[model samples]
Target: MTQLTLDTRSISRGDGLTDQAYKVIRDAILSRRLAPGTRLSIPELSRQLDISRSPVREAIARIEYEGLAESVSHRGAVVVEIGLDELVAIYDVREVLEGLAARLATRAADDAFIDVLERNWQAHRDAVEADDVEQHMKLDAAFHRHIREGSGNLRLSENLRQLQGQIRVAMTTTVARRGGMPAALAEHRSLIDAIRGGDPATAEQVAREHITRLRESLHDAASAERHHNNERRKP
Candidate 1:
């Protein structure tokens, strides 16, 4: 397991302590810092952050509601481990909805939204250049999020936000696995160019193609893993 510590500086700004704690813990879980199935100790986190247990407790509750943490009997909260079926389900839904977001974002194109995308893309490039996989994954997630929010479709944005939290591990895994980062970045650059050109059709097409490929890959990987598990169990 990687030693994933909370970045208190990022969380400490502006937001309430509980929200800060929640985001910190959530990012750790998403970045595979805290990792799946790791036991969470409220008192421990509180001690580490020099904060109170109440905020940590509240953060855990919010995390639980978002399906990122599970309350184990006598074991406290543990990060949720995503299974094969959930990975497939996540990519399936994400491909369609994210494509829709890209299309809608094209329609919503303006200086402000485009700025957010460029900034995120630049940050991602820096992360990749620095070989900081965790920061790269964080920017990758943010890159998708900007498109969703820029879509001007409130419901669509909200839905993806909920769904992304649930399947964050998959996104992290996809980027962290290596060898695909540059290709993914090129795809995103293409996406940015399409959106900047205000061509909704091209934007949507590129977005769909990117996600569809990922979905298929994840599906195949999951299937293979499940098969291996079954074989092991039989022997």
Candidate 2:
């Protein structure tokens, strides 16, 4: 098992300047620090991050390509808000790609890979038990990343990493509403079991079901948020 360094702060340092800026901004978006629909001003970002506008502009362009941001006609770049429709579309794609990754991982993974997964699963369970939502989310992301890498497909891993940013936002929103960390842990366990069993069909089925449940939960949260905001606005 490789020593997993979970320092998200330094994730940007290893890449090029523009790439590093992109990751930093992307991480903020994923973690909801930037929030959905937030307008990203290049000058503002450059000042905040103590970098030049050129790199920030480059970063925004890359993020736009990833569908995490959009280039407005005159308003500049803005974070892409995940609507119910986008949520369904993204998860549908995730189900297929993640299931394929799991299937490939099962065929290629050795006992060590399984052990690493089990350890990650246990850590996730512990985080849930402790009611540490942040840690739980981080572990959950790591666990999926491990599976993608273990799949031995560079393209699959890259695609999953890109998609992961969007998924994180939805996951964070859902967790904030439902408060069901234990259920999420159980789902992870089920996913691991299906992969370990070497049953591609079962793996795909479970993956889709898990993502579908997540989408439903997020939809419920979004609806509740809308209702709450409406009431607040009334009086």
Best by TM-score: 2
Model 1: what TM-score?
Answer: 0.78
For every model shown, what is its TM-score relative to the native structure?
Answer: 0.78, 0.79
Clashing pairs in 1: none
Our model 1 lands, by Cα RMSD against the true structure, at 3.7
Name the runs in model 2 displaced over 4 angstroms: 1-15, 170-172, 176-179, 219-235
lDDT computed for candidate 1: 0.83
lDDT of 1 at 203: 96
Model 2, CA-based lDDT: 0.77
RMSD of each: 3.7, 6.4
lDDT of 1 by residue, 14-111 (tens): 44999889888988887678878888888788887778899999999999887888999998899888886787787788888988999999998998
Clashing pairs in 2: none
Q: What TM-score quantifies how close candidate 2 is to the native fold?
A: 0.79
